[model samples]
Target: MSSSTSTSTSTSTDDETSSPARRRSPLRALFGRGSLDIQSTLLVMLLAVSFLAAIVIGSVGYVNGRDSLRAAAFDQVTSIRESRARDVERTLAGVQQAVVLDSRNDSALQASLDFNAGFAALDEQSIDPARQQAVTAYYEDTFVPRLDEATGSSTDPSLLEPTSPAQAYLQSLYTVPFDDDFDASLAFDAADDGSAWSQARSDHHDYFREMVDQLGYEDVLLLDLDGDVVYSAFSGVDLGTNVEDGPYSRTPLADVWATALESNTVDSSFTTDFEPYAPSLGVPTAWIASPVGSGADVSGVLAVQVPTETIDSVMTGDEGWADQGLGRTGEAYLAGPDETMRSTSRELIEHPDTFAADVVDHGTPTDVAQRQVATGSSVLLQPVATTAVEAALQGRTATTVNTDYLGHEVLAAYAPIDVEGLNWVVVAKVDTAEAFAPVDVFTRNLLLSTAAIIVVVSLLSLLLAQVFVRPVRRLQHAVNRVSGGEIGVEVPVKGHDEFSELGGAFNDMSRSLKVKQDLIDEQRRENDRLLRTLMPEAMAKRYKEGEETIAEDHTDVAVVYADVAGFDDFSRGMRSGERLALLDGLWRSFDEAAERLGVEKVRSSQQGYLASCGLTVPRIDNARRVVDFTLELEGILERFNATNSSRVALRAGIDTGQVTSGLVGRTSMVYDMWGDAVTLAHRVQDVSSQAGIYATERVVQKIGDGVPAVDSGTVTTQSGEQRVFRLERPAA
Candidate 1:
């Protein structure tokens, strides 16, 4: 009994394991036919499509957003740049006006004019050698004294009061030229290494030193038109250090002098470099040159130099001005046209050679330079420069780009500085990564959020697919039922959102579909009615099916034309309602007759009707039909003429021709016949003598020879074409 029980228990265990109702083996489920879950596959596809759609939309949104941001930034930058440039231009204009006013107040100019007037006032006899010498001395020395006495120090204040040491020195020099002994002494010293001139030069140097101190400049240099440094603010510097001596001195000073000379001629301003002086002084300096003379000629250049730190202080004074906006940082530099570093920030000044080398290495395109100067506005999205000089020369007020400047990517801005007489370009630069750091952060966060949203949507789609499978299956069955003509199948709607609205719309659509089906049946019957009126039912059906119907050719077809006389006057007198009614009545009558005669009505115009016979129903007696039509029309008109107060009449012209007739015009097809016979028929109606039937010669011959007619003389049309016609009556 124990052995049998153990064997039964083992069999029971095996039966339980192998039972068909037990959970199916995962391996068999995976490998079995028809085992793939369609619902799960559809869910995966939906998730994939949604993810791809999200990515596409996000990518487009990101690009468009970035472009819009960049464009707005560029516009803002451009406006600010233009505003700054206008301010600079206005300031420069004020300085120019001041200079011009000052030039007119020049004492030397007034004195020379007075001297000329005084000399012109004197006779030629009074201009002898002794007299001339006396006059010259008196005019040079005493004339100024007399003027001072007469004006009482108020006539010309800048000259009368020596406000500056330079003015004082100039005053003293004016008296020396008038003093005979001092002039002789200067000539004697000129022969002896210019000792007398040296004293004057020393005085001038002292004056420059005092002026430099007063003006708050670190150094000042006075340059002649020949590029000679005649005076230096620093003491013990040689008076005659010709700028043309050494290569460094020659090239840089020559460039500065040339720029200064050019500025003077135009009463403009420019920046220049100290060159050899930069290395010697252990600090670089820039010179700002302005002209000092009044009429026609410029005397010399007054150049002042300040430490670069001064400019730095000015640029950084307002933090708000420099900040620009988010993700931007900057540094400023002042440079001359020769690409020489003038004044710059501490960083650039400390590494002079490096910055200078960078500036000198690059060149600016001519078109960009012209635009920068001419428009005086900022350019954004311009190509970044590898060098400081190139950045300045390119003329953009701001630039944001990744570039290898001194072997590093940098963002830069170069603003033009229009100091009174200075042509300086200010460049600001920063590390590219530092400037664009905020953008990178924003972009990264945006991408991360987008990725998270996509993942959530994909997971949500799987859950939603399982939840909606049964409801969607029911909706699919209902849709199939509706499509298969099982109407009024109620679909259960559970939601209150768009899905509920969709259910309501589906119910309405079902009702509308039934109504539309009934209407279509009624329309088919109505279309058959319209077809019988238009043509034979069979032909109309063929036309409705888009089959082209070739009209059969008929020889000797009868064409009739009738037109209203004095219709323009009648139309003008009649009300629009009356006119329309009249036209409707006339066309209806014409159309009825045409249908009864089995004739094809070609076209009807505003004041006329045209019909053709023997086209659809070809008959050898087309002329006889035409004559019958004319007599019938005459009888209709005669009855109207007896009863009408308007006395309107219809004139009919008939012609028979072998012509090709077909519908013309794609959108509004109208039957028309084209041939010389058609033209002659129209001419016969136009040139007819009275309101009666006029027939062309060909039409007359076609009607039987027994037909009675009166010969109308040949009439010449407007184009000088002769057409013979006759008034015809049907055989009596």
Candidate 2:
């Protein structure tokens, strides 16, 4: 019985110990004692967050990088295009300037003047009966004999026959003494005095020679006022034949002459590929012409005929960019204004029809070629030869683009060549894929680098989450306490790392946020004060929201332009501050008067002030506004004259005009007016002499018959000449 009792006690003790151990094991598992479930879950969340962060960062970086690179590339292209354009413009400017300078030279002008004077004097003197008879005899006998000796013919031959240099030289000499029939044949005895004839010949020859020498060009044909070639350095061509006889003779010289007469500036090219002479010559030439004159008068046109080869060399020369692995590779072709290829490589030159056949077949070309011809630069990626051709015709540079040219995608650059009188476009093209090869390589490398980093970051996120979960939980609790208004809650710094800094920062941020909120409230009050000072509450709020106030046009507006005489000199001598003060004082007084008159002051500058009436309020008496303003300005000046020794008087000119007043410039806004009426008002002010007020005829009419105006004659401006009248107060 004792043995049975002992066995039952042992069994109950074992059961009690085993039950507690089983329950403790399950509790430990739930709280992450042995299993890595808690760590694993935290790690998975961290990796997912890291992966999202990496993708976001990588995408943002790629987009930013791509945009930056694209901007840089576009900038590079713009710089290159602008540089080339400027160079071309500058070259044209230089040629124009040179021609003007040549025309203005004392020697050239004096020579031309002397020649005309000499002819006039000769006409008067050579009209005497005795001299006339002598000239008539000289022309029939001595002149004809000399002409036959020089030209090897008695009568003038048809211009159809090819001319010889000797004949041309003789013709030039013969025209000297043949001013009249009497002068041509008249001859004194060899033994008698020959001074007049010899002197006349020498003077004539010298004038012609000097004039020819001044036009120092070989490929150019120099025409006289009559459109006849006076001289040609090339092939020794003479000008006795009509202009229609020459290759480009039928082309209108009148157009060039008219352009030269109207504008002192002349830099233009003409095309003539369809002309009879062009095809006969085998290569079309460009004709570039510039007016030879100063601002005074158009002397003559200086034209040059440049061959295609000359232009080709200039367009394709090797430079710094060419050596830097950025060389442009393509076939260059010259096309006429008619869209016909003028010149190309020998192979393409023989087959001009196939110049841009692939692009033309696709029918996707815009009016890019036409725009290029007109504006001088039009970038296009189209499959059309006509497009490029049209651009050349408009005197513009163009680019031809296509996904494939004969099965190869191409990017072409076209430049207009204005040679002589011809319009030719130079096209350079290369494979598009090859051109962007570098960019592709860079993009691939970037993507690969980003992928590698993402993988590495994902693995590192797992380890980091495992190491910092306990510390992070403690920090989170501290942050919550601080956020709940528990000040001075200490967050334990477990490591000298970002987590420790983050804990301290969070504590500081809580304090800072409260201070910042208070400061923000104070700033809002300050801003309200400023807003009240600048504008009404409603208007200020609307302005803050970036809403623009609509402005109505004032029909009965009185436009005023006030200018100071000798202000230009004052500005030059005085310091900027003193000048500013003077201007400010004048403007302040003007502004006060404008406010009283219910007018809106538009703009003010160092030169003058411009203002308008009936902008804020409807004007009942627009004429009265002008009169009152003028009188008020005079009174102010009179007061100034008494007080200040150095008196500054303002000249106020007034006129009535329709005005659309509105604010301009976002940062520094100003009210301004646009249209012809406003311009006319300003011009009226400009025409005023000293302190006088000049008004246009329209303004004077509006003032009624009561206000007398003195006729001020007419003033001419870019708009047109206008009859101006001087405005003054009626004698009282």
Candidate 3:
């Protein structure tokens, strides 16, 4: 009892001394008492991975949403721009057709003639000179003041005054009476001035005025072939003035008059770009002119002023911008080659103060904004020299984000309008802040959602770490056992979580491994069997051992080459399926016969069968065995002929000599023989004209009297002449 107590005390003292060393060890320091355990480590790693994934997903989603919203915004603006362009082109084309058709009609021609004749008669009739002076006073006092106010230009009224007495007399009646209401003057058709021109006006004036109202024209005028404005629908200051040499000769109307006169065809019409005109209170005007008569009978030119409000209506959706899918801060407008707007500005109509401040901020003079506001229009007033406008005027259609005329970043779509004579570009734009508002909201919500996901995942991962680690630890133990060479080790499966499925899979895998090991051994035996069938056993062994090249020279070997002599003609009458089936059966019989006769089949083709003796396995009577195999093939073919109505006979050759044999291909390897013996056997088999077994002298001498034969033929060789014999079965 004293000895046992002494031993226990010594062991206790030793353990106490080793405990400090154990605490200071590398492994202990790595996972010390204060360090994180496996569960904590797993929780931390899962949370880190989840946070990273959430960030990546949120970033990617934001980028994609921003891109999609940008693309959608561009598409909307581009669609609106293109639609507005088409509307502008369609409106201009309609105006051109109306002018061309009206100018060629009978009423226009008669009115042109009557107005011209009546004007000449008025000059001869001695009209009142005082009334003519009143026409000049009306232009100087009333017309020029309004023209200067509207156009912001100082113009002498004499420049727009009538140059003839007949012009003064006509304007004194039609125009001077309605100086207070000039627009109503076009409708004043019930005049009884007793002049033929006045009577012509009463007849055709209402028709022309209705055309102006129905077709949305500012005015319509008839000019004689001499460029004399003989009749006017509005009877403005341009009445009876020669467009060729009048004071307003520098205008686009004069240019159109010259073009119409120069072309002189009824179907030919001319158009002019928008320009400030002295008439109609100096409103921006474009003109369409067509010849008055058909072909060579052109008597006069007809001019129609293009309406600005009609184009603005189509482009702005009749000022209902929001209804056209353009939300607040969006507008569609046209810009001329001069960089001035052709359509009205939406901002000027909706928010004039904002328009003024924006334009001035973007480098437009303050006076220009004031002028636009005064006229209550943007045409020929607002300048758009943006990148989109420049590109469009250069005939490029594109959608992009750029600084707009007001210097605001905008999503703009621009394209050139396809009008015949106008160098105009259509632009549809929306402020970037407004267009990307949804994207901003999406980004904010995405960030909030990502934070929520991180919080939820953090809590869930802490719980899941415990759940996941238990199975992992169990699996690790089982895997260690397997690594230690204990296969078929299984872990206990618990709940139906992924861990449970994984444990079940591990157990199934352990069981499948044992079964697969046996299957592998069986498959190896099968592969070896197939390999031995393809080549000699020795060569197959070397091939499976990964031999790169395998060839052997055998000194005394017998090779037999046999074929169906009439197989071509015999198979010609059979279908492909029947022929193949017969060939497969015949080869099988030959193979079985070869095995019985101690011969090995090298390879067989549809044309022939080849075999060897004493190549793979040595035999003292290899020649006798090969000759017997050849006779057996003859019997096989004879049986086939009897059963299948085939007339095929066996032709074979046998040679006994040194030959080289080896596996011959890379992927689909084949065993074959090549040497003088193989060559001579092929030559002898082909030379026999009859169906018989031919043999070389070597084979004949080897077989001796085992097979009966006769001298057949001679085959030429490099050594000298080799004799061939026709061998027959020994009295079989």
Q: Identify the candidate with maximal lDDT.
A: 3
Candidate 2: what lDDT?
0.50
Question: Better model by TM-score, 2 or 3?
Answer: 3
For 1-732, candidate 3 gives per-residue lDDT tens digits of: 000000000001232234434533543443344667778888989998999899888889989988998788888898899888888888888888888999999998888888888877876665587986798789888888888887788988777787777777887888888984757787688479788888888778888988888888888888887788888788887787778888778889888988988886888678888888777777889999999987789888999988688788898998888988899989999999999999888888998768888898998888898899888888888889999999999999999899988888999999998877779999999999988888888888998899899999998998899777878778767765654446678999988989799889989988896577566657667767877777778887787766869999988889988888777787887899998998889989999999999998887778778888988788899998999899989999999999978798988888988989987766667778888887777778866688889999988888788788899879899999999999887874
lDDT of 3 at 589: 98
Lowest summed lDDT window (length 10), candidate 3 = 1-10
Which one is best on TM-score?
Answer: 3
Worst 10 residues of 1 by lDDT: 1-10
lDDT of 1 at 29: 48
On a 0 to 1 TM-score scale, where does candidate 1 land against the true structure?
0.37
TM-score of candidate 2 relative to the true fold? 0.38
Candidate 2 regions with alpha-carbon error over 4 angstroms: 1-43, 103-218, 236-241, 244-247, 252-282, 290-301, 307-438, 462-732
Query: 2 or 3, which is superior by lDDT?
Result: 3
Candidate 1 residue spans exceeding 4 A from truth: 1-39, 69-216, 219-282, 291-301, 306-322, 326-329, 334-340, 345-404, 412-428, 470-732
Model 1: per-residue Cα lDDT over 628-663, one tens digit each: 666666666556456554566677677777666543
* Segments of candidate 3 deviating more than 4 angstroms: 1-35, 469-732
